[model samples]
Target: MTASLKRFAATLWQADGRRFPAPLSLLLVGPLVIGLCVAFILPVGRLLAVSVWNPDFTLAEFVHITESPLYLRILGRTFLLGGVVTVLTLVLAYPVAFLMARLSGWRLAVATACVLVPLWTSVLVRSYAWIIILQRNGLLNSILTGLGLTDAPLPLLYNELSVTIAMTHVLLPYMILPIWAALRTIPRDLPLAAQSLGANAVRVFFLVVLPLSLPGVASGVLMVFILSLGFYVTPALVGGPETLMVATLIGQQTTELLNWPFAGALAALLLGITLLLVTVFNRFLGLDKKAAS
Candidate 1:
């Protein structure tokens, strides 16, 4: 055994020896990387080309989007809706994430299961559930009426509020998962150290926990915002004219009006915005590190 080991080491040290990486590595990676580039990258390239490059390479599409007050209004509204959904998800997810991180064995698992259970269910089904809960004579409205808050039901569904609620609900798991993971990475000793120095729980959270958790919060916010920007099903289901988002507008233009070029332009712009935000997030918060675990 010792002689065999010495021979093997001597052979490896030979100047003409070849490297030993598996031949299957390239075969495994090449096709997958090429497939992604061909499927996703090429289509996005075409959409961006159609957005700005017409037959004569004129700036007509750009001008139309910028000049039209309606387009600007829709763009602003989409951003506003995305922002609100992102904020709502953050606010709702933080406590859930903290509890999941701070709890022990079975309690943590149960909490995580609850958050993920909704994610496994269909978004359309959840949206429909919200509709039933928020509509006139719906559960929420009936409760409010029974409580003497109002004689008539409130207009809850078919508006921005409904859309925001649904989108936030749909994207909440994205916020919670990242935040919980981030909180888990924090050593338990840090909070104890803060407390040992006479700091209260509130101060420890705001000073130590919150700062350490910002990376996760940033990642989750970006994820929710990007998802909300491209959301069509929820907005289409719940949003009225007052709550029309960019994705629904793009779909209407392409499917109903047959304005393929305009729809392509809108879609390309949305994709660009999503990529830009993600790049910015990676630069600021190191998503790669959190995602690795």
Candidate 2:
């Protein structure tokens, strides 16, 4: 087997002029590629087939979706929720990441723990934690009442605000870690150089820091937005019926209604849109190229 691999590597090296690494690398990655194709690609292809092939190839499921505004509206709402959560996480995470980048010793450890501890916790636990905090008589309301902020318990749970807050909390780490990684790569002298050039702190951040750290920002936005689009637990727990999203709608069709074909259609649609968004991000940010290197 060793001799056979050596021969194969030699043949590939001679066939390709680039380098031995270029042709010899496939052997290392070949098994994982095959595994993904068998486990993920084939199943997804079958899912797409199921959506359009009810007895025979037909567009009925897709046509039904287009004819009714409900699914499309829910999809739009999903995008809006994702955008809101992504923006919120970015705004909140950037400052946290900046602070983390500057800290050292125990302070750095504490900051890192603050970002990662919740990430290691269960999503269900976090969702329910929010429910407990935001419920009508839960933590926030009780504190508010004690402080004389309101005459009675506020309706905090089962609303868009509650959903947004929970999602922001859950997704905040995704935003933070990427920005932190990027911020860590920046040299300390760059900021000092900007200060020497008579640039104020705000100007230095916007002009120097922000542009240098854009790749991390792009990565964080992509992750948070994509995850938010498919969020089910947090929204379902803390949000009302009026706050329906694409994932919840898909879940209803798959389980309650037992409409697998329709559910498959919705799932396929979501998958398609997610792929398109990823492609757009790759095109704009060169993330794919950066990742490959």
Candidate whose lDDT is highest: 2
* Superposition TM-score, candidate 2 onto the true structure: 0.88
lDDT of 1 by residue, 49-154 (tens): 8776777887677678878999888888898999999999999999999989989888877887899999899998998999999999799999999999999999
Residue 281 CA error for candidate 2 (Å)? Answer: 3.4
Candidate models: Cα lDDT each: 0.86, 0.89
User: Residue by residue across 1-293, what tens digits does model 2's lDDT show?
Assistant: 99998987577765557655754678778999999999999987887888987777888888888888887888888998899999999999999999999999999999899889998999999999998999988999999999998999998888888989999999999999999998998899999999999999999999999987888998999999999998998888788688889888888887799988888898888998999989988898897665453
Residue 127 shift from truth in candidate 2, angstroms: 0.5
Looking at candidate 1, the ten consecutive residues that score lowest on lDDT are 16-25
Off by over 4 Å in 2: 1-24, 285-293
Predicted structure 2: lDDT: 0.89
